[model samples]
Target: MSDKHSPDEKDPHDPQGMRGGLTNYGDTDFSLFLRKAFIKGAGYTDDALARPVIGITNTGSAYNPCHGNAPQLLEALKRGILLAGGLPMEFPTISIHESFSQPTSMFMRNLMSMDTEEMIRAQPMDAVVLIGGCDKTVPAQLMGAASAGIPAIQLVTGSMVTGAHRGERVGACTDCRRYWGKFRAGEVTADEIVEVNDRLVPSVGTCAVMGTASTMACVAEAMGMTMPGGASPPAVSSDRMRVAEQAGAQVVEMARRRLTIDQVL
Candidate 1:
């Protein structure tokens, strides 16, 4: 096998490397100069370039309705970062929504982890705010950050709005499954099940109930990975944007403190 595919060839899967294959921008003098020059070409002034770099992990897609607000969230995060005297750079990574993935979302979580870790390491950012929602994205990001060992914070996309059916309130897969189960047991008619399905996910965001998405959000808080009260806000709420902004500002503080992921984890 070629060195590129060789397992002993410095682990293509590893996110920290001098050559910047996947992690740590290839340190070649030419690559370094090219990267800086290209970034400069984007109209980034020297003053802005000199500031601490804050990376935003954007995992948005039509398939992942959970991150439907990714564009707005990222913009808010950038605004906060720049306002706090940090340079913001948004980057893409795998976006896995539980309902959209094949077999299971778990199967792809590790792949997302690899992508996130390598991307974070490859860039020159002093810190990163992981923007994710849904059942698996946050966990995958945490795994990546744990491996990358950089200063990192998590910002959830927030929960979906509650839906109603025939004057009955409902939200997310838990209630979704419950209603469906009732239909399968002949307790609810087919038309009723269809109506319930439409009402279950009334808007774009993560599950409204304290399901996996909410659970992971809480887990992040419990593990001290998120700001206080970061886990419970509704996705479309202004509070969610405030959380994003706070996340951006906090990353700047983290950069100043030189608090690596090891410290936070």
Candidate 2:
């Protein structure tokens, strides 16, 4: 694709051409004045504020380290949206960490879906990028976006790094349980078990196993909800940031193309 844009660059899909739907905002001068005055209160200027709007769904929580990179990802996404000629706005939804919720996170997945659907419905976004990690958050977001039938894309928080112990590579929960079982069976000492626990989850990210979190990541990719190969990036890698940026740019394209979620799903 050509990266350069001439002075006469135009989006064929843009309904109002290069100037956008400014005239549709108002046919009369008084109506235009009221609209501009109200929007200006949000720190918008006539020159910099006519771009399409992109919404970002943030589902981070202190309880969910799988999303530890969320704030950084959001900033990167916003930068990409701005660079791609769109206005990025982020909003929060209920974060459901599998380990933290009671009665199973599965039970509350619908609640998160409802929250996401309602927020997207009430918002003025032309397109949205749903950011999530953990076990159930991604699914809930997908369900809600499907129901809302808007232009939406998904970005996962990425995978966790592998843990290590005395020249042995380990990870979370899976190995955690394995070693704990050994300890319970009197096959390993208490000190060894403690050491295993310390070595597991040495980095900030999701479960380092093919658990629900990883499974959901794979499902998101297989369903074509996310960019190809996005599901496997290590959470702390700089590549994850690039993925976030691309997500922002892609949302703008989706909005311009009017490719709503209903069309994709």
**Total clashing residue pairs per candidate?**
4, 0
Model 2: CA > 4 A from native: 1-39
Residue 90's lDDT in candidate 1: 89
Q: What local lDDT score does residue 133 receive in model 1, on the 0 to 100 scale?
A: 86
For model 2, residues 1-265, the per-residue Cα lDDT tens digits are 9675532244434432123234454444454456557778989865454677787998878888778889999999999899999888789999887778898999989999999998887665778899988778888999999998778999999888998888989998799888989999999998898888888887767887989888988898888788788898888999989988988888889988989987876
Candidates' C-alpha lDDT: 0.83, 0.81
- How many angstroms is residue 12 displaced in model 1 relative to the true structure, after the best TM-score fit? 28
Give RMSD (Å) of candidate 1 vs. truth.
Answer: 8.5
TM-score quality measure for candidate 2:
0.84
Stretches of candidate 1 exceeding 4 Å from the true structure = 1-31
lDDT of 1 by residue, 51-105 (tens): 6778889999999989999998998899889889898988999999988899899
Q: Which residue pairs clash within candidate 1? A: 19-26, 24-121, 24-122, 150-261
Local distance difference test, candidate 1: 0.83
Q: lDDT for model 2, on a 0 to 1 scale?
A: 0.81
For residue 30, model 1's alpha carbon misses the true position, in angstroms, by 4.6
